[model samples]
Target: MFLDEHTAKQQIVAFAKSIFDRGLTSGASANMSVRIENAWVMTPTNTCFGFLNAEELSVVGLDGTLLKGLPPSKEFRLHKAMYDQRPNDRCIIHLHSTYATALSCISATDNSNVVPTFTPYLTMRLGPIAMVPYFAPGDDALAESVGKVAAKHAGIIMANHGPIVSAETVESCVYGMEELEESCKLALLLKNENANTLTAEQINFLLNKFKK
Candidate 1:
């Protein structure tokens, strides 16, 4: 279900407002982009999600030209890297959500799948989340690291940064981000407890049954 540019812009605004209102992200720390036929409708740099105007969203060409509106986010390279790796993904959401950011600060035993599978929903909504080692914001290497893993993982957590998720639609991308945040919350909450995470067998079953 490819979206026209107008519809993509509207959806980005609506969902961004919802994400902002719920405190999923704050200030201008987050960015979102929707891939249209020849371009991407993206949140502008330094624009607050709560106050986004659909008309002000950047329309960027595949070659990174700003075709319309304000300049694309400074982290536009991150979005582009993911899109380059996953041709089927239509929307990309990057958020500095609280719990997920907190989780990102910690070292993971497995960088390939940093966030633990606390429940089935996280696995069903998002597959294993890869981890990118910390790099300065807007660093090209950060995008390079993401591109290396984006093909295998729809979700990613950047060390000392936050989560980036992509999906076939804006709604699915938002939902996956929410699930990642919530799963991080659960993981933090159970850090000291003898938490019962889903077994490998169960995870394989879910992957075979529901992975997209």
Candidate 2:
């Protein structure tokens, strides 16, 4: 599918509006983007979700030039690196929903910290969530660091930061992000109880059934 500049602008505005209505983020805590042909359409820096207009979205060339709108978000490297590697990724969402951000602030890979196999839908959407080491926000090093496993992850938790999801569409990306947050919420709720935990056998079955 060819993504025209006009459509890219609309998707950027619409995606921001949808997530804003869902209360996924507030202030300037999140950014959304889409790959349009070889370039990308992204939300501009310091913009509020509630007030985004199509004209305000930024057009960034694949080679990293700011082609239109206000300057892009500080998380430019994070978005660019994903599109540079994942040819099919059309939408990207980086959000800081309350519980997800809290969990990320304290997550370590040693936690066996996969987002859990608690829900079939979540499992199917975000296959494996990677845990990336902490870097100062908007740091180029953060984006390059994630390049190590870009071939495997759909959503990755930025240690002490938040979550980033890339998918074939905006809705799918949003759903995966929500699932990531929900999984974290579910884990907290069941941390004290041994109930509903996935058995090794069940996980093995799922692993076999959901091979991407």
Candidate 3:
């Protein structure tokens, strides 16, 4: 079920603080949006996740008009693109978390699925992560690129930037983002080792069993 605006604001603020308190994201480098009927209650532009004010959160109509509160995130298009493609998803979180951003800075062998399946949680929660080529932050082109892959990816790693995760609820979106970060950490940690990544069959089984 979609959240009502008030609860969406509270959930956004609560989870944003939770993420920031845990060092999942730093400063004003992250943003989140939650679907509430025909509009989205989103974090305001330049607001730190740790310091969000629920009463001051922005609300944008589904067509992208600002309906209330402070201005929505400058990267609002990124969230819009994903919401448009994933109709069933109610929340989207984009973070510049360290490990995931570090992974983004590297050249991925497969941009279609950047993170390797070092563990099942990432795949179970986010499926394959698409890596969009770098575009300056807030560039509409970045949103366009994200739109191209959002339908197939519940999670994405923007090159030279970081990860964006979406889910049917606030909790799932946060957990998926954490899983993405953890997966990136494991991938970097075992980069030089002969890590026995999960095989194709195993990954497919997970995709079928856990993904909707």
Q: Global CA lDDT of candidate 1, please?
A: 0.94
Which parts of model 3 are misplaced by more than 4 Å? none
lDDT of each: 0.94, 0.79, 0.94
As a whole number from 0 to 100, the lDDT of residue 206 in candidate 3 is: 98
For model 2, how does the per-residue alpha-carbon lDDT over 63-99 read when each residue is reduced to its tens digit? 7799988888899899878766777778888988876
Model 1 bad stretches (over 4 Å): none
Error of 3 at 45 (Å): 0.4
Candidate 3 per-residue lDDT over residues 128-164, each given as its tens digit: 9989999999999999999999999999999999999
Model 2 clashing residue pairs (backbone)? none
Specify the poorest-scoring 10-residue window by lDDT in model 1: 113-122
Winner on lDDT (1 vs 2): 1
User: What is the lDDT for 138 in model 2?
Assistant: 85
Give candidate 1's error at residue 172 in angstroms. Answer: 0.4
Clashes of each: 0, 0, 0
